[model samples]
Target chain A: MIKFSNVQLGYGGRPVLNALNFEIQKGDFFGIVGPNGAGKTTLLKAILGLLKPVKGEISFLNIKRGHKKRIGYVPQHASVDEIFPIKVLDMVLMGRYAKMGILKRPKKRDYTIAEEMLKNVGMEGMAEQNYRELSGGQKQRTLIARAMVGEPDTLILDEPVEGMDIQGEIAIMELIKNLHTEFTLTVILVSHDLNIMANYVKTLSIIHNNTLKLGPVDSILNEETMAKVYGAEVKIINISGQKVIISKIK
Target chain B: MNDFLINLEFFKYSIACLVLMALVCSFLSVYIVLKRIVFVSVAVTQISAAGIAIAFIAGLNPTLISLLFTFLGVAIFSIRFTERRLSNESRIGIAFVVSSAAAILLVSKSARGIHEIDDLLYGNILAATPFQIYLMIGIIACIFIVHFLFYKEFTAVTLDFEMARTSGIKARFWELMLYLTIGAAISIGMRTSGNLLITTFLIIPAANGLLIANRMKNVFIIAMTVGIISALTGFYLSYYFDLPTSPCIVATLFLILCLTLPFRFFYRKS
Candidate 1:
């Protein structure tokens, strides 16, 4: 479980997140949806202790400097440096750094776990290939495997499916669903695609004007909320038993 | 050829000194070339030269004066750029021009024999003392240790600083480490190769290494090897031909670079 109480985040001069309070229960697949500059990335950074919250406190369950072996992260496509000439396996093994520390090399057990995680993502074959040579979807899968190899209790993915083709997107979505069930992991995903999120994410958190609306997907997917958050009308409809959203006619 | 080889026996220490200087300089060259910090090397060399000239004028030990001025210059250079947010290129330009001018003026005014000044300018490897040899070894060891201990962080920082910070690696600390390492190397090698000839040792071998090696570890190995060869061969060639040692060493590195070019082109094509 994780808790954020009245958390405020900002750069030196401008505030981005204002007095935001939220709690993420264990084993919940939560998706945050909003337009650009919604503080989605900011929220993740604050949780990771990468940024200092201008105000308030964030606490984690059984999380110490080295004990938070349960948290993993898959950043957006633009986040990773592709120029480093690291192989897919090497990138995944980096997740083992916290456990391995400085002196100890990554053990056989670590490689075994990483290889298994790669296989689970159906990317075991590309383990030896340079990471930069992989396609966008393949890269995402490798990153996911990297996060999974750490055996994290909470996995946070920021727009992991962005810029992928339809097939790639669907594959990633299915992979997330399977990972959630297999690991019983708490997933916090930030996405722009509403329909794909609706299918898998049990809970939806919409951020706008530095405030958040938290509820189940069905309850929160509505025209009024969408207009307020995105400044546009969103029409929600069910087509072939799948939730689809048609934008409002301006 | 046999007679020349027999006569060159007195140059053994010079050859050894060149090899060691090459090792440290070339190892740092990979970063300097990649990051385009070639001018930082130029600036450090000139400022340290100026410090030496000042020491001669003030009746102080050249090595002690050089270290003091080098540290002072390093401090000013590091702090000003960090505070002003100046790019490394611009800082190097400012430091290089100002320091070189100061050195020229100080050397002109100093009451010294032209031979001693020329010896400093063209580097007398035969004159490299035991103390300097130990200093160079110590500095090189420290550089190697720093890079090894923080390999992951340094890799991330060198490739992309912002990502390294977000991924929980401290960037400022590593940047400082890099600056100090470069300063220490320049201070130690300034006496061995002088300001001008040091470039051959630093940039040439590292560039050669980059051309051949794809990985950082391999690059370091290749650089050290290239540097050592340039040093020993260059010194012997100078002794046999009765040429200037600095120019001979520089020409030796330049020849090695030329040799690597054909391989570099082929590697790219493949």
Candidate 2:
């Protein structure tokens, strides 16, 4: 688990997210939701240790001394180098680099694990295919496989299916939901839409105006919180026991 | 016919040096192309050229002067600024333009060194001394050895930098190491093989390899193969047809790049 006590995250002495106090429990499928430029990424970056806090510090609760918690990070596939010549399996195997020694290469067991991950992600058939030619959904699956291959305690995905089609989005999100259940892994997902994440995540942290409200997804998905987060008049509807937000800025 | 080739003994040494330089530059070229830092190479070369010119003006050793300038250039290029006001491309472009001007102006100040500067761009491969040859072998061997030892780390950083950092791979150290090697290679490569041939070897071969192979390992193999082939064929063509060596090498590389199109076309279809 990770804890943040009065943490203020920022860049260049300018605070973006202020007065954050929260803890992500072990094996929790957590979602951080916000609109564009709402310091959501700043919070994620701080948690990832990519950005230092301006005020308070983040401390680990259950982590061991002198050893950092291993995190498997899956960035937006669009942000990756597009022109590199890499196969799907090769892309996934990059996750094992940190686990092996500096001079060590991936061995048979590593390949076996990588191939198993690819199979779990439903990409076993395309392991030899060029990564550049993959569809958005397949690429997302490959990226997920890449993240999972390292066998990290925590998996962090940043907009994993932002550019995918509707079916692809559902499939990837379901895959993530199933993985969280099957592996008993701590999953932290970042997205701009609360409704898209509401059905999958157990807990939600809604960031707005450099402020955050964290609670169970059911409590946080109500109209009042959605309006405050969006700065708009909003309505919440129940579709198959799932909360969906309808907002109008006007 | 064999006697004629044997008589061209000094020519063989030049060819060996060219092939070795090509092999070394081609190794880093894959990273350079994949990282999309082609402009960084251009900027480094120009900054190094300016250093050579400045050394000539100051009566200093050109290799040492240029190596220092190349290191400075690498450091500047590797810095990640918190501010986003000026894009990185703009900064590199500014450095390139300024260095180019400085190289011309500094060399103009030392009129006698102008011919030597021309030799720097076009190279004097046939005139390489024994000391230069030995120095090149040492540097080239070290480059190959370092890459062999740290290739996994380098490939990890190049493939996905943020992922590497998240995995606690010391991405910045690897990045700096990668740039340092590239800087050293450019400075030394330009001196012996000329900037024209060095730039060609640094970019075209990797690109050509990527056209035919989807696997990174295969791409690297093909890149080195392309470089060696061009070096040998270009050297022979220069000897037989009485053409310029540097331009002949560059032309051959470009020709091979063009020739790889069929492979790409077929690969796409397959």
Assess every candidate by TM-score: 0.76, 0.94
Leading candidate by DockQ: 2
**Residue lDDT tens for model 2, B1-270:** 464487577576687788788888898899999988999988888898888788878989777888899999999998877665778999999999999888877777676657776776777788766677687788888888888999889988888888898888999889988998998888776666876788888899999988888788888999999999999888888877888888998899999998899878987888
Off by over 4 Å in 1: A62-66, A77-79, A192-196, A210-214, A219-221, A232-237, A241-250, B1-14, B28-127, B145-183, B194-211, B230-265, B268-270
Extract clashing residue pairs from model 2.
Answer: none
The residue pairs in collision within model 1 are A70-A152, A70-A153
In order, the candidates keep a fraction of the true contacts of 0.09, 0.76
Q: What is the DockQ of the complex in model 1?
A: 0.16
Question: lDDT of all the models against the reference?
Answer: 0.77, 0.85
Q: Tens digit of lDDT per residue, candidate 2, span A1-250?
A: 8899999987776778989999999999999998788887788888888877889879767778777778889888888877888889888989888888799888999999999999998997888998999988888899999999888888999998888877888899999988888888899999875667888898999887787888898888887877776777888788888777777656
Chain A accuracy as TM-score for every candidate: 0.94, 0.96
Chain B vs. true chain B: TM-score per candidate: 0.89, 0.94
Where is model 2 more than 4 Å wrong at Cα?
Answer: A248-250, B1-7, B238-243
Calculate the i-RMS of every candidate, to one decimal place. Answer: 4.5, 1.1
Query: Worst lDDT window (10 residues) for model 1 chain A?
Result: A95-104
